[model samples]
Target: MTYVAVALLLGLVILVHELGHFLAAKAVGLPVVRFSLGLGPVLWSRTWGGTRCCLSAVPFGGYVLLALAGEKDYLAAPLWRRIAFSLAGPVANLLFALCCYAAVYAVSPGEHSLAGYCVKPLAWTLGTAQAMLAAIPRLFGHAQELSSLVGIVAEGGRFVGASASRLLMLGGYISVSLAVFNLLPLPPLDGGKIVCDILVRCRAGLARYYVPVSACGWLALIALMLYATIQDVCRYLA
Candidate 1:
């Protein structure tokens, strides 16, 4: 049951991230092709307004596809608008973390001094995010202090068994971690998109290279996930 709760919590966190992109696109009048929850074969779908919203069979991750002609076509929008759209996803994750932390604090003020748990978490989260970003390069050189989805569920279930407050705190940490991960300047990630927009705004010749680089980045990300998953499986089996 605790693992089930963690799975549900993860779904909500993902929804929060995707909602940021969906709302931002609507606000800026960008054409959103599909807003999908999960990946693989479509489990269910419905068309609404200009977007086809659906749930896929696998619940690994969600994505928002744009109806633009190509990657660079997004540049047709104002730079600020593009940046906002790109940054919205990660920002939403950050906000979700804050809300989770705030909710937990509100429920049990006795667990922590008021000052220790409230706004300080927001500041601490930002600092933690920066530290995580600085550690990304270590993924190749050493075993990273990162968790795969399997690991998250395992740890989250243990926390849930301990106490509801612990589970909530874990959720908050996961939210912050997701936000920071999305901000990495790699392609197919929110941070990479943000950087691409910035380069375009700066009229840097390298702006054109963003898409190609991101393609490679996606492969690297997949490899990283696979490595992390193997580590998680080995630990679990042991």
Candidate 2:
């Protein structure tokens, strides 16, 4: 039950993140091709309102695919629109975390006042976000501290147990983490893509390198995931 809860919690967070991208793309008049709720082979899919919605075999994370062909290519969009689309996912995760924290506070209001009811959640969410932002500089120096999907699920399940409140708290933390991580200025990440877009806009000559840079970024991300997974395995074994 704990494992199932953890998986569902992770899936919900990923879905919220992707939903933000999907909505932002639509808002910017960009057509969406697919919105998937997992990473691998599709278990089920349905097309609705011109977008293919999918549920895949894996439950780790998901993605939103935008239709970037013909006149509606992502590159052809205005810089602000592109940036907004890129930022929407992280913003959605943050909002989701805020809501989770709010729910937590609503359930267990330490203070009985109306001010406490409203301010506590906001304060908690902001504090967590601030701490996460501050920790970004130390991430590279502490590779072993990084947790892979497996490690996250395992540890989160243990921490959450069967308590709904604990589950909410854990989900909120993961959501905040997702928001922060996506904002890192590395290629293929949302922040990295935004940076690249800005650079290309400033110097159109650099447009040629975007694909290769994105490929390299993906490679690096995969390598990091593998390293984290190995670290998790070693830690568990010890």
Using TM-score, give the best candidate's number.
2
Please give the distance, in angstroms, between residue 237's alpha carbon in candidate 1 and its true position after superposition.
Answer: 1.2
* Cα misplacement distance, residue 179 of candidate 1 (Å): 0.7
lDDT of each: 0.82, 0.88
Cα distance off (Å), candidate 1, residue 3: 0.9
After superposition, the stretches of candidate 1 with alpha carbons farther than 4 Å from their true spots are: 109-124, 127-140, 204-208
Segments of candidate 2 deviating more than 4 angstroms: 70-72
TM-score of each: 0.88, 0.94
For model 2, what is the error of residue 41's alpha carbon versus the real structure, in angstroms, after optimal superposition?
1.7
Tens digits of lDDT, candidate 1, 1-238 = 8898899889888988888989998998888999999988999999999799999997968988889998668777788777778888888988888777776776775656767666766875777677777777786577756679999998889877957777777777778888888877777788887877887678867767867887888898898889889999899999
Tell me the tens digit of each residue's lDDT in model 2 across 1-238: 8988898899899999999999998898878999999889999999999999999988777888887763226677899988999999999998999888878877874666677756877787788889999988888898777899889889999999888889999889999999989988899999999999999899988888888999999999999999999999888889
Model 2 — which ten-residue stretch has the worst lDDT?
67-76
